[model samples]
Target: MTHIRNIYCIGLNYVKHAAEMGNRVPEEPLIFSKPTHSFVKTDGNPIELPADKGEIHFETEIVLYIDKKPDPEFKVEDVVGKIALGIDFTLREVQTKLKQNGQPWLRAKGFKNAAVVTDFWDYPGTDICRNTEFSLVKNNETVQQGKAENMIFDFHELIKECDENFGLDQGDLIFTGTPEGVGKTEDGDEFILIWDGKEKGRFVTNLK
Candidate 1:
């Protein structure tokens, strides 16, 4: 049997995404989670889209792959660890309805193949904390664009918050959240996830 862990996510970490959602300035960072089975890796494998869902939206985020077991008495600065790259695929319509009804974001965010990630890489560097452009494209047309500097809670704070509630351990993943300009994608669309000043990865999905 395949081992499954936990999927932790940050909501509206990007200020522009908050504005796009018509939310007033937030008092604290928004948090959510997806099950371990939600993870998908592109090792020359095909990703299948949900047949029952409509207009699947793309939310490009910086995903951190935890490698250390969190210590109860650890300081926030000590949380530094390896991170992976990935895109957070969201069902916008479902998410909107859930929000209006004051419900949890699980159903809207935790579907199969909803979180697509790449192989883990060592923590890029401290500069990734200040400013880094992240974007997504479909068929060469950019759909979402954002910067890490726009996050309400930077990397350090994000890791701290996660540690406070749930102790992070090896193989755990955290999606920091997406930026503004998110939109829909039709079947047969080739999507690309790009992190500024780094390598870009591409994947194609079809509506089944």
Candidate 2:
């Protein structure tokens, strides 16, 4: 099991994604969270969608693991840890209605099986912070692609914001939002993330 103490998610981090979703590029990062228990095993365990939770959608993001407390004052290089490309699964209908009514939208995103992550890859050392890539391939075609250089709120900024809102500690996670091409998911769909040119089998989601 992947150990997770707290989960923090960043929304609208990618400028293109924000525009496509009809949102403005935020002045700062938009952050959300999935409960610690929401992380399911990707060690061959299937991703199950909530069958009754309206229409389920998939958003691919680059996930960060916090190794230490973040500093609002220190340079970004000092706070981040390992990285992984993960899915921030969502209930699109639930979210849209909530947004219209001005409600907290966690209920639409932070549900059981709403979060599933791949094994962590060590953060590209200080020399390489923005070269990482996040790609989601459905079936055989590339559906979404986001680069670190493209994030409106980069990892360091997100960590600072996350610590600002909730104190950060070892074992906390920060999911740095999704890129464009988010769409409804179907049963037996396999998502493979082409992370920085490397192929990682995310899941085929045996949704029941």
Candidate 3:
């Protein structure tokens, strides 16, 4: 795997996800980030999470891998070389408190192994991708599903926002927000990421 330079994440990008979180659809992308230390691949080994942190929730999302710095007028096809399904694990109670205090989400969202992704596949261009549906199965149950078409800020828009605000670098990653149906996780929970109706990756949880 390429060494990750930075990890950027979008919030409230999905319409149903916004509603489920009791948040209004954002006019622009609500951006956040996780540290590189949080990165982990879904290699079948158990993923360790904080056990004492109250209620960690799973947010399944489509992750984009930037191959190089994008040009000013770059399209999604120009910079994104690969794609994968990932989970943006969150400490629910900690995140709630952080939000109430108007604080950054790093503490709640940037824990170790919090950013989990599958092995990437070559991006098949935006047309096919926009129509593709990806899903997450938790403990043998389909918990969340999403497609790029439902994003409030689509892939192009997201890349533009990142370039304009954060300046995209090679190996940077973006978690393009999650869909609705996010719920609490537990010890021994297993997560499977399915794309194009095939199991792409999976990992079991080990709360510590």
Candidate 4:
């Protein structure tokens, strides 16, 4: 397994997602972070989540894996060494409260095992990535679907934002935002992450 360093996430990158969340689409990429402890693999184990915590919503995203420090004139194709389908689990109630209080979203977004990723696969180039569609299936029903072309801030722009502000390093990950159709997750819900119409990962939920 590749050692993960930083886990950067983009919120409201998709226009429809922004609208569904009742927020206007931003002119720039909305970036956030999840602690390293939030990372988890899709191994055959149940993902334990907070049962008492208000509704937890699932946001499926296309995750990029940085293999090395990028050059000043790095090409988007050169920056992403691997790709995977991942989930940005959100505690909706906590997030709303934090937003209302104008607080950082770490408490609502950075819980343990909050970031779930599929097995890494080689980067399939810009054209393929733009054309590929990824989705999340909850209990055999497709809950969320997204394509790169639908992104407001494309991959190149996202990389630029991260590098300019946070400085990307090898082993850093970017969870490029989710699409519409996000909903509440219940205990025993089975989630299957599909990339390019193929199943890449699956896991069951155990809300405690």
What value of lDDT does candidate 3 attain over all alpha carbons? 0.93
lDDT of 1: 0.75
Measured by TM-score, how close is model 4 to the native structure?
0.98
Residue range 1-208, candidate 1, lDDT tens digits: 2233678888888778888878876677678998776788755556787867666887778887666766766543355465556777788788889989999988888988888886666676657645777677779888887777778887767777787787777667779888888777677788777776455577788667
Error of model 1, residue 147, in angstroms: 2.3
Give lDDT: candidate 2, residue 20. Answer: 89
Candidate 2, residues 13-105, lDDT tens digits: the string is: 888888888998999878878887678655665678877768888898877888778654765556667777788999889999999999998
- Give the better candidate number (1 or 4) by TM-score: 4
What RMSD, rounded to one decimal, does every model reach? 2.5, 1.6, 0.7, 0.7
Better by lDDT, candidate 4 or 2: 4
lDDT-superior candidate, 1 or 2: 2
Candidate 1 wrong stretches, greater than 4 Å = 1-4, 72-78
Model 2 bad stretches (over 4 Å): none
TM-score of each: 0.88, 0.93, 0.98, 0.98
State, as a TM-score between 0 and 1, how close model 1 is to the true structure: 0.88
| lDDT at residue 8 of model 2 (Cα atoms) | 89
> What local distance difference test score does each model get?
0.75, 0.80, 0.93, 0.93
Q: Cα miss at 103, model 1 (Å)?
A: 2.0
